[model samples]
Structures are given as C-alpha cells and as structure tokens.
Target: MTATSDGTPKVAIILGTRPEIIKCAPLIKACDRRGVDCLLIHTGQHYSEDLDQVFFDQLELPTPDYNLEVGSRSHGEQTGRMLEGIENLLEAHTPDIVLVQGDTNSVLAGALAGAKSNIDVGHVEAGLRSFDREMPEETNRVVTDHVSDYLFAPTEETKRYLERESVPGEIVVTGNTIVDSLYEYRDLAAEKSDVLNELNVAEDDFYLLTAHRAENVDTRDSFDRLLEGVSRFAAQTDREVVYPIHPRAQSRLDEFGLAVPEEIRTIEPLDFLDFLRLESAAALVFTDSGGVQEETCILGTPCVTLRYSTERPETAYVGANCLAGLDPDDIVEAGTMMLGKCADWDVPFGDGRAAERILDVLAVGAEPDAAEVPT
Candidate 1:
C-alpha cells in the first residue's frame, strides 16, 4: 500500500456494475467517516443511464477514482480486458487490501487481479451458489470465493457452502450489504421519488417487471418466452405491467424481434430512489435479478422470480418468493400465485446494519474491536 506520509492503511474497493455501486455505498461512507484512504475503481461493466451514472447521482456516491471504460463485450473479452486494466492500475497504486462484491464478471476479474498480485483480497457477499454452472454468475462466485483471503459471507448458509468448498479465509458472517442499502434508501425513495405520479400508476395496481439476467435475455427462445409470460399475465389480470427496461434487455428485444405488449408499458431505467418507490408501490414483482429478490423480501413485497433456481433460497423458504422459470405458463401461474399471497413473513435478510458490520471486518479484520464500530 502506498502510504500517506502519516501512514494510514490504504484500501481499494473495486466495482464495475450498478448493483456494486449501490451495495458498496455504505462501506465507502464508512471509510470516509473513519479516515481510511479508500480508492474506488469502476470497471464500467454496465455503463448506461440507469445502470451507471444515475446511481452515483441519486446515491450521492463520489465519482470513481478510475473508470476503465471497459464497456460490454463477450464474457472472455470483457473479463480478459478487465483483468489487464485492473492489474496495471494495481501496479501503479498498490493497496493493503482489495475488496470486491457479488458475482459479476467484474468481481471475478477484481478478485483474480488481487490474488495474482499477492494482495490480500476480501470478497463480500461470498458463498452464494445456484448450483448451475451454466449461469456465469455462479462460476464467478465460485472462482472468486476460492481465491479470496477474507470471505465476508452474508449468511450461515453461505458460510457452510464456503466450508464445503474448502475456501480459506476469515469467513465472517456479516449480513448482506443490500439490507443496509434498503434501509438507507427506502426512506429517501418515499421522500424524493415521484415515480408513481409520473408513471400514472397507482400503488398496488401494477406489476413491476425487471428481466435483465444474461441467462434470460441473451437467448432468442428464453427472451421470447419471458416476454410472452409478462404479456400473458397482463392479459389475465388486466393489471398494468411497468417494465423499466434495462439497456441490455432493450438491445435483445430489438435483436430478437420480440415485442412488448400495450399493457406492459416500457420505460427507461429508473434511478435507485425511483425504483425503490416503484417496488413498494407494485402489487407484485417479477424479476430474474438476485438483488431484486432480496429487495422484494425486505420491502415485504411478494415476488415471482423468473428463473428456475435462485442463490437466495431463504426468500422462498420464508414465503416471500416463488421460483418460476422462463416458461410462459409457469411465469403467469407464479405471478398469479404471488398476487394472491400476502407477504406475512418477517425479514429473513439482516437487521439493516450489515454495512457497519462488513466495514468493521474490512477495517479491523476478523475480530473487529467493539470500539471500532459506532454506537
């Protein structure tokens, strides 16, 4: 780590996607509050309005110290480019510890770069598995976990997975940072967002749909099937389906010649606050994103996951989520079932203080002194 003449430890938080920015916000703030020299790196993995720039503005996060601008490419091409860019950056500005989050290709690249450099690496939100190797995210999560030196798992279940896989690290059971963000932003969403008024949709009268997972969107058949399900559900329920189209999803829609129905009004991707308000306002949510599943559970909103499997089985076990793969009939049935079921379960995630716990471990290692955490 390049030390300031005063000698405080230097840390690097590497992130490349919009979700990473959102999840990493509290940790960044903690660093600033505690006087840590934390460097932010944006690999530009998901660079667009909703996916990128708006998050920084709405979340009030500082602009990244470096933007690799390594926009979309094939998986091999994107990861290889990121690995090269991050390695070069690390050589120029060495850090004591490298922290990465979730299972994006960016996370994989960041972890690989740090390990290869012999830097101590911390993997946040570690040990999640869908058991589906076909899902690139599963591969990313598995590979990153193995190489990390500090594994900050979100739950006991995840910790067990790491144990089974024989991952070496101080696997601290810090709750998920997404819980921290949900608590941090939900109030802000209520206070500042006018999404409901702007969309002309009443609370609990719409279905919030977000399908941007590569597994769901990259293929012609799967993409067509998902859209058909959304259309079918809308036709059956006569409920307006609000889809804030992910840039990636929009491209696939055009490429595959699939059409969104009149009932499913597609809008530009929303800023974080706006999206949170919409999530609470919706009667039910249909999504393929892991982050959304956790968000839905925290918001006490019923959700129909548009994937056959989820890394977040806790949500399903708690009666807040239903798994419905890309099949149109299954999607419609699951959405219908979710609409009828009320989210009566308690929050199974965390106590909304995970960011503080995670930052404690990052700042002070496995046994964070109580004094290091604020009251």
Candidate 2:
C-alpha cells in the first residue's frame, strides 16, 4: 500500500444510502483528524434530495468528490452500473484503500472494484448474517466480506461469523460505527431539533415506524399485514404512529392502493438530527431497518422489527428488540411484550470509538483498543 505525497494513507470512501452516510460520518471525520487523504464517492443509489442530500447537510459531511448518479433500477443493473463507475474512479484516482460500510449494493460494488484494481478494501460493520439467502442484503454483505482485505466486525458474534466462513481477511472486533455516530450526534440532535414540537407530539407519547426493505414492502400481503398490525397496536395504545416513510415504501403503498390507518401519521423523511430526536423520544419503534435496530437499542428504545429475521440479532439477544414477522397478531403481541418490559437493557454494541479503531488498523495496522472491543 502506498501513501499520498504527504506520506499519509489515501482512502476512498464509497457510500450510496442514508444508513451508509450516517454510519460513515465518523470515519470521514476521523480521516480529517488523522490527516488521511480522503475522497468521498457517492454511487447515487439513493439520489433524491430528501434521501441523500439532507443527510450530508445535517451530518456536516463535506460534499462528495464524485456522484455517479446511478439511480433506481433493477438489482443487477444497479450493481453493474456502480461497478463500472467505481472502477473508473479507482483507476483514475488510485487510492491506497477503499472503505465501504454495511450491506448495500454500492458496498458490494466498491469491494469488487477495489479488489479487481489490487487496492485493499476495508469492510466496516462486517460479518453480519440474517442466514436467509432470500434477502438481497444478505448476498451483498456475504460477497463483500469475502473480497475485503480488512473486515471490521462490530462484535465478537459478528467476528465469529467471519471466522466460520474462513474469509481470507484480517478480522478485528471493532464495534459498529453507528454507535460512534450516535454518541457523537445525540446531544447535538437534542439541542438543535424540535421535531417533537414541529410534529405536535410529546415525548414517550408516540410510536415510530419505518419499513422499506423489499421483502417487507414490495409484496401486497406482507406490506398490508405490516401496516395493519402496527396500526392496530397504535390504536389499542391510543398513541399515534409517526412514519417518516421512505420513498420506495410510499410508492408501494400508492401502487398497492393501501390506505394508511387514521392512527398512523405519515410524514416526509427527516434528516439525521430530527430523526435521531424522534427515535430517542418515541414510546416505541417499529421498523424493518437494520441500522434502526442498532440505534434504538443504543438509545434504550424498544423496537418491534417488522421482519422475520435480522442480521443484528445482538439487539434481540439483549432484549432491546423483538422480531415481529409480518403478521398483525404477531406484531401486536410483540408490541405488547416490548411495552411491558423496561427499557434498561444493557447496550451491547460498543463504547463509541469504532471509527478511530478502524482507522488505526487501516492507516497503521494497529491492534484494536482492548477496552472497547465487545466480548
């Protein structure tokens, strides 16, 4: 690996979705602190101003160096476009290392491009498995982990998954960077966001819902069941459910001609600060998002996941979340179970220095901080 003219490592950070931006914010900032020559590349998988630009503004990240606007498309086409665009950038810029976060198609493309170019690839939040091959994200993450030169697993359990696969990468148990992002921004969100007032909701008086995965929202049966179940739970509790609906999920609702219940309040998607504020204050959260599972757990908020399985089972293992598969009865039961339980469960993610540790390994091949590594 070669260093830049300044004798510092050069890193190309590739991301496309909201979760990736939020999770990678810390690493981006860490590069600045460490004087690493960093380049931000966006694959434009999520190209909307609402889904994409707002996150960069609210998170205080610099504008991306390049935006390959490969917007919505079939899975194969999207991944293929990303691969072409990322490979061209890799050849021209020739960074020493490529870093990708989570299990998005952009991540898969970044890893493939970096490996094909003979540049080291570092996979952050690696070694997650839902064990169900039906999910597209499962395939993306599995392939990325194998191609990566550095696998930064978020927990011992996640690291174990990599070991079991015998992936030819150096595996280090660096806790998830989402923890770092949350710890860094939670106080900022609380101070700067008045989303509760803006939405006319009170703390601990509303439920939050976010469902956008294809398996959960694309099918009529699955999507209908999810909305009905969460609506029923909200009605029984006499609390309104706030949904900052993702564009894809909203389009599905329109296509399927589904009517949202009166108890559910649908709103435009929020920026990170506002969403963090709502997540911190909501009575309970319902979602099919993996990042939200980790966030809600870290915030001590109860989550009823709207999926049959999750890659982040650590949240469920610690009693911070429950899988409510797509059944109205099951969803309501899961809500009741979580509502009855206290929100004092121990956070199992990390101590919030994951980005620093990941950069340590990538920049200088240092050992992970022993104190912060989750057992």
Candidate 3:
C-alpha cells in the first residue's frame, strides 16, 4: 500500500538486538546509496542505551522509522507482542518485502508476521545451524529460514543445510554481510576508538571475552564454571582478559553472587567501533557469540568459542577458532593450543559486497529498473 511513486519496492527492515543492528547496517547503507526505498523498524528487544542506541550512533545508521518498544519478557510474551505490533504495521503500510537479519526472537516474529500477512520476507544470514534444538537461537534460525521468501545464505555449507531441509525460498549464497561492515569500519575504528589507551592494554597482549548466552550465564553452575575457566586461562597466559559484560549476564552474576577472577576485568558494554578495535587487536578472543566468532576469525585473531557446539564450524575447520565448552581445564588447554598457532587462516566469509548483492536481488524483484546497484 505504501509503494514508491516510481513502483520502487518499499522494504521494511526489522531488527531488535545489537547483533542484528550490526549485521543489517551495511544493507541499510546500500539501500540509501542505491536510492532504494526502505524503512527501519526497531522491535526494542534490547532497550538499553548502551546496548542499542549507541550502536546506531557509532555506526552512523539512521533513526528507525518505527519503534515498538517491546522490551524484555518471557520468550512467548515478547514474541506475541512483536507479532501483534508487526502485523498491524504490515496491514497499515504493506511493504513489498520485510527484511530481517540473524537469529533472534525479532527475526522469528518478523518472518511469521510477514508470512502470515502475505508479504514477502527476506532472511539474511540464513541456514546457519548448531543443530542443537535446545538453543533458542537454533529454533529462531530454523523457523525464520523456512518462512522467508529469500534465503541469503552466507556459504555453501549453509546452503547445503537449506537444501537438505528442502526450504521453499529462493536460496542465494551472498556471503556474510559482516565482512562488508568489518571492511568498511576497521580503518574508522582504528582512527576513532581510543579504547586501548583508555583500558591501558597493549595490542596482542590481552585476551578479550564475551559470554552472554542464556545457556551459559542464566545458571549459576554454568556461569561460575565459565568464569573459573577464563580466570584459569588468564592466569596461565599471564594476560588480562577484558570482558565487556552484557546486561543480562551482569544481572545473573549479581543474582548468583558471583565474581570474575582478579585477572579478568569486567567493564561496561562497548559500542561497535570500540569493541571492533579491541577484537582486532586482542591476542585471543573468547566468546559464545556467533558474531564474535566470525569477527575474530575475519580479523585473523585466534578465537576460543565458549560453547559445546558452534554454528560457525568454519572457524574451527579453518584453524581460526577452537571450541572449549565451559570446563576450566578444557578452556585452559584450548587457549594454550590456540595461543601457539598462527593467525594466517584463510577468510571463508565473502568479498565485502554481500549488501550490494542482497539489494540487487531485491531491486530486480521489485522492478527490473528500480535502481542500478554498483558491482
């Protein structure tokens, strides 16, 4: 109903979390450059100014066209709220396509809302699987991929998974958009982020950590073990571990009366640029975030993934990362092993043009001559 005057398709880009913001930024920028008509919608899954608003400011992304303010709640309640709000939006300003990136409650709700409303939905970073149904993210990823009209798979490995599942979407291997954002912002991060001096840490002399997954941090035993492992690793390596704690993780630590070891320094959440600068320079990065795994691998930094299984197996296969499930001994061993290895692994993501490719596909679908996308 809200088509552009020239029949240029209007796309509604929906996101709710910090990771989604980071991944979708390149596509948003591409839309602006190509004169593609698009509107951004914030689901407000992450409402903290530190976690949400700072990303837009640091990335120079435009303010969202709509903000549902559907703050945190039980998964069912949160998804239900988002579904209701998104359905209303779709009915009111029916866009030609609804675009969502990454696996989250927001992704699932957006895909379902679009599908139910009879509107096309495009899923970015589709077909990634840890194959662990217990992980909520895995469910979100699987459900979103199936409901999407366009599946922008990041690799042949991911494409194979979709093929095996026989998803109905038109599958395109457009590589990962993270590559585009990283390539675009690395130099800017170097020039602008003074995080190193502020933290008083030297490049390649410290370890970086991020463990905020519910499976890891929601339980006391698991959270305590994770901290113990990282503490042990830091002591053995004689290097400080910088942990920019997530709000949820911080809350759990307080509730459980837990503490990080002396060698591990906990700090406030960082904007994308500062975090990118630290990730790029850190000697080793430890995390349970799939995004961090991809980032550290792309930056040629050795990574220790803090989970039993990873959706990003390419990182492990390419010698860029090792999985050390929450055991202290395992974490120390993995850290020691990775510390001895070289950081010259081949990048498996893409050529830094995924956003352009995605927009091109959408443009052709909208109208043959919608806009001329750059090669």
- Top candidate, metric TM-score: 2
Against the hidden reference, what TM-scores do the models get? 0.94, 0.97, 0.95
CA shift of 287, model 3, Å: 0.4
Tens digit per residue, CA lDDT, model 1, 190-219: 989998999899998899999998889999
TM-score of 1: 0.94
lDDT of 1: 0.86
How high is the lDDT of residue 267 in model 2? Answer: 98
lDDT to native, each model = 0.86, 0.91, 0.90
Total clashing pairs in model 3: 0
Colliding residue pairs in candidate 3: none
RMSD in Å for model 1: 2.8
For model 2 the TM-score comes to 0.97
After superposition, which runs of candidate 1 have C-alpha atoms over 4 Å from their true positions?
1-6, 49-51, 365-375
User: lDDT, candidate 1, residue 15?
Assistant: 95
- Candidate 3, residues 1-375, lDDT tens digits: the string is 345557777889999999899999998888887677777889999978556878998889999989999998999999999999999998888788899999999999999999999999999999999989999999999999999999999888899999999999999888899999999999999999999999999999999999999999999999999999988989977999999999899999999999778999999999899999999999999999999999998988999999999999988999999999999899999999898468889888877788888877766332233323221
Give lDDT tens digits, candidate 2, residues 341-371: 6887887878888888888776543333425
